[model samples]
Target: MRVTLPASGTEVDVKSLSRTNAKRLGEINSKIAVKLAAAKADGVTEEERKSAAEELKALLDEKEAMIAALYPDLDFEALPNRDVLALIAMTVDYSLNVPEAEIKNWIRSGNGEQTQAA
Candidate 1:
């Protein structure tokens, strides 16, 4: 995907473009460094890998929200949801070492529908 910068005809890949998302993404990327190290070790459990991916995906989606919020004039809706989600999932997989139960707890806490049940 491509978007023209404000007041400039030059076009750039949507990933390269930056607003608030840029900084948050940098943090995510930094976090991934730790994940990658863990993944390289031979004994990583399948659950760990899965949790890392999911957290990465969530962060990337968050980055999209940040970009959209910061650049309302830019037509971010043009970006494909699958692409964005996939990137986020991959990021979560590659970058974080969250325990699966912790993530599940977080998910449960945020589930509005389930909140009523409790």
Candidate 2:
């Protein structure tokens, strides 16, 4: 599939994640959740918090590497922040096969459900 960056309009060719890659992504997300939980746990020491932060950083680096591999031609460092985010969103949408309308609703409602006025 092809996605155009929101800011730069650079067209990127993206492939759906293979089973192995999707599993790896799930593992990465689980690790991040663990690190976040550790950081937020009651009676967490300062040293423990710092360690969790460092671990989270490393996990994020790995995730970024995976994303780079997925979008090989996309130059993330040179892209504007909005473009970078758009690419990530595109990746999620493509990888999960999420409907475009659902994504738009998520963006509109900020929590994936529409709000009714009082």
Candidate 3:
């Protein structure tokens, strides 16, 4: 399964997905692959790049909220920024049914900050 790490543009494929969800996971992977590839190849405009990062954060937040709602026992508000990013990446990786460890590693290595091009 291929999981897109929002913090980084790299798409990683890992062998871990339930047979039932594998197809859906492939669709998601393709979508992310296209978006990242377009941005990489065409060179995302400054504004578009900012928008992408914001969109990623918003998506992560939405997923986090959903998880919190479904699992009331889990505390989602108390984690540090890095941990929160890691958690979000992990959740996304899981939702896509990919390898959580690879996603976590990618998130851990990400800068998570926008740097303007000079």
Compute each candidate's TM-score over C-alphas. Answer: 0.42, 0.75, 0.39
State how far residue 88 of model 3 sits from its true place (Å).
Answer: 6.4
What does candidate 3's lDDT look like per residue over 26-91, in tens digits?
555565566566556675798886766666556445545654443354455654555445544565
lDDT by residue for model 1 (68-104), tens: 5543554556655544443343234323544434433
Better of 2 and 3 by lDDT: 2
Q: Considering lDDT, where higher is better, how would the candidates rank from best to worst? A: 2, 3, 1
- Quote the lDDT for 28 in model 2: 89
Worst 10 residues of 2 by lDDT: 106-115
Those runs of model 2 whose alpha carbons end farther than 4 Å from true positions after fitting are: 100-118
In candidate 1, which residue ranges exceed 4 Å CA deviation? 1-25, 80-118
Report the error of model 3 at residue 106, Å.
16
Instruction: List the candidates ranked by TM-score, beginning with the highest.
Output: 2, 1, 3
Candidate 3 off by > 4 Å? 1-34, 80-118
Q: What does the lDDT read for residue 105 in candidate 3?
A: 53
Which residue pairs overlap in candidate 3's backbone?
none
**How does residue 16 of candidate 3 score in lDDT?**
33
Taking all chains together, the TM-score of candidate 1 against the true structure is 0.42
